[model samples]
Target: MEVRSAPSLLPILRSRQQGEVLTYLMCDPDRETSMSELAHRVGVPLSSVHREVERAEAAGIITSRRSGNTRFVRADTDSPYYDSLSDLLVKAFGPPHVLAEALEGVEGIEAAYVYGSWAARLHGVAGRRPVNDIDVLVLGEPDRAELYEALGGVEGRLGRPVNVVIRDAGWLRDGSGSFHATVTERPVVAIEIKKQLGRDPVPQSS
Candidate 1:
């Protein structure tokens, strides 16, 4: 499963300060959810949760209806965009990238960015189909692409396919990036600190 693109998740991410709230609601397992339960689960103030819910409803990511005093939220998975994004997620989390990073034994890889589906889950939006393969952006080096290729080979020896995205420290310094804006958002995972450490609590070292 290879994902070139997903539903314009860009819209969902940029939908305001409540991006995490709406994302959690859509990814919740319940077909229809209640306002109070949602607020409680997200651990935000009731008022702030309500504000986000309203914004999400307007964006059409969720469907809400009143039954007596409760409002239910069901994800619009039927939306034309849902399938595309879901498929991308299936392909994205295929294998853990920590396997590669730990084996490489090369320091200065700097920041390892786990973008895409796994990041969405970290923010509390778990897709039905999650692959868990680490999708990373390696922010380091003077030459971006060439450096990525070199690191990719190092991981290749470790048996994990590493898609290392090298970012030129100088270019990053200059702020000329109009291309990588899509992946710059926060990572989608539950244990975010594991991302920085470059190792899982339980190593899958079969």
Candidate 2:
């Protein structure tokens, strides 16, 4: 059985709990979760969940409200809790900041954003690591040769080759005009606005 800590300890303990809440919310930001459910998932009692939820709400870590008889919870990443949770995530997942320099400093590269499972693990950043091949969503409609040039730039920068994706709305349909549901289905982690913009360029945060 877990003993309830002193009132003063609540503040200290809430940080970790806040991180848990954020992790859940990050998976699906729109849905609402209940206090009882959250307590069960976290292995804490309802009363503690209530108190922590209240504190987190005040700190803007999460937003809570009464829906009839239930209190719902979700992570507010824009809140300061984001920084703490991000740090915890890095500690939990093996650190891989080295990938940033590899992807970022390449010439002719329009823009890059991470997507997929590895991207989910990174803090609101959309890229995965320990991946067999890096999956990056790039922008523009460069020809195959031009695209190869851009990809080569990334390969040179990273000391390893990475697949480069150039997004083009104009190329939405090929000769057959068939839909490429594949690109639309790509999992999105975060939408990045490029410091260097061209077309509808968005970065996948890492």
Instruction: List the candidates' TM-scores in order.
Output: 0.36, 0.34
lDDT of 1 by residue, 1-206 (tens): 11222223333343322544554544332546677776765455677777777865676656778999887776677566555543332233322333333424444554444556555654445477743344565554425554455556534332344554556433223434554545543443222223355422211110
Q: Give residue 165's lDDT in candidate 2 (0 to 100).
A: 58
Stretches of candidate 2 exceeding 4 Å from the true structure: 3-31, 80-206
* Residue 42, model 2, lDDT: 49
Show how many residue pairs clash in every candidate, following the order shown: 12, 7
Worst 10 residues of 2 by lDDT: 90-99
| Candidate 2 to native Cα RMSD, angstroms | 13.4
